[model samples]
Target: MKLHEKPLIRYATSKTPVDKEGHLYKKGERNTSYQKRWFILKGNLLFYYDKRSDREPLGVIVLEGCSVQLCESNENYAFDIRYEGPGIRTYKLAAEDQRTQEAWVKALLWANFSRLRMLVQDLERTYEQVRVDSGPRHRLTVLGIESEQVTTHLGRPVHGRAATHRPAPSTFTSEPLENFVELHERYRKEVDAVRQEWLSKRNQQHGDPPVADLVDLN
Candidate 1:
């Protein structure tokens, strides 16, 4: 659907991340003629302008449930951005070359909010798992020999509770663990902040009310 919504335009600016921007020949629905327009893609919204200098966009396409694919056409590097909903027009576009066409298609496909959210969640899970795995207990558990036997530099076996208390391995230093924890905490804080910022920006773009409260990261 084509919309020149103010909220969308405002959201497009205001320090939003630009995923891609370029010139493309767009096939007009009524005229059936290709016109080159400047397009800027920010998150899921694709905004187009008659010229690159225009402050206001001609229209914006919300690519939430849209799909981009190559289309058979006389024009080289032609593709279509299609939405399944009623009243939504399929956008026909052509890039300069095959490489550019593929890049744009890839960017549009991954621009869907659902896909981006899933990617963010997956990264968070991976980071958390790494942090857990870096802990002393987990490292010891993985090194089964550490639990079964404790030995000295001289290769003598230890016995009882005293035997179990072997010095920490040189590989596992407190300094490195402390550094990892600090970096992990910083990364978590940054991710949480960016996630909240995205939520706010999304709400603004959709004209929805601001979220009542941020999710607890603890």
Candidate 2:
């Protein structure tokens, strides 16, 4: 079995109050209002939600949305779609926590990449089995032959039919190995690109000299 590339599928859904905020609501908090919504960002669809708490500085709500982008330069994008009762606000996560955002960004990228890898492996196995089953001569049939003066003959079974071959164990192993290798390579490249993007955005936010500037020649 050989692993081949396939398009990635994204699954997105939303629920009222969302997961995290819902937990908080269950904790006897009456002053907070929570709402959940779903929408597509770039190309990937995600669930976005937040809870409003009545406290000084107004407890901040973290709204999140994710999507996959095919553009070589941008493989995925995520943003916060913030809403405060009657008014709606949209903000890019990149704008906040410039120094430590890569951790979160990498996490999301890895999750999506992992799902794509699993799908590829499953597809490869199915295709390989199908090809093996379609081989020539599924079952042999006996034909009559002339005997004596009469053109009559009897037919009998010679060899028992072979059971569908259980695709060699090796075949199953090879496909996933190849898929993992390819997936790892692709994921590595994508991760690097995404990390670099984050770094660039972070640098832009601070408008400081590159990290190299902080190094002393002494």
Per-residue lDDT of model 1, residues 24-135, tens digit only: 8899888798899999998888898899998878888777656565667656777778866788788888888766776777667656633334443454564445444334
Candidate 2 residue pairs in clash (backbone atoms < 3 Å): 44-67, 44-68
- Assess the local accuracy of residue 206 in candidate 2 as a C-alpha lDDT between 0 and 100: 95
In model 1, state the lDDT of residue 122: 51
Model 2, range 1-218, lDDT digits (tens) per residue?
A: 01121211112222222222111111103422222222122222222323333111112322222221111111022222233354443332321232222333333333333444455444334333433444432221112211121111111111211212221111011222224445444433433444445456668989965553221211
Off by over 4 Å in 1: 85-87, 113-218
The list of candidate 2 runs beyond 4 A from truth reads 1-45, 52-91, 135-218
lDDT of each: 0.60, 0.28
**Against the correct fold, how does model 2 do in TM-score?**
0.26
Worst 10 residues of 1 by lDDT: 157-166
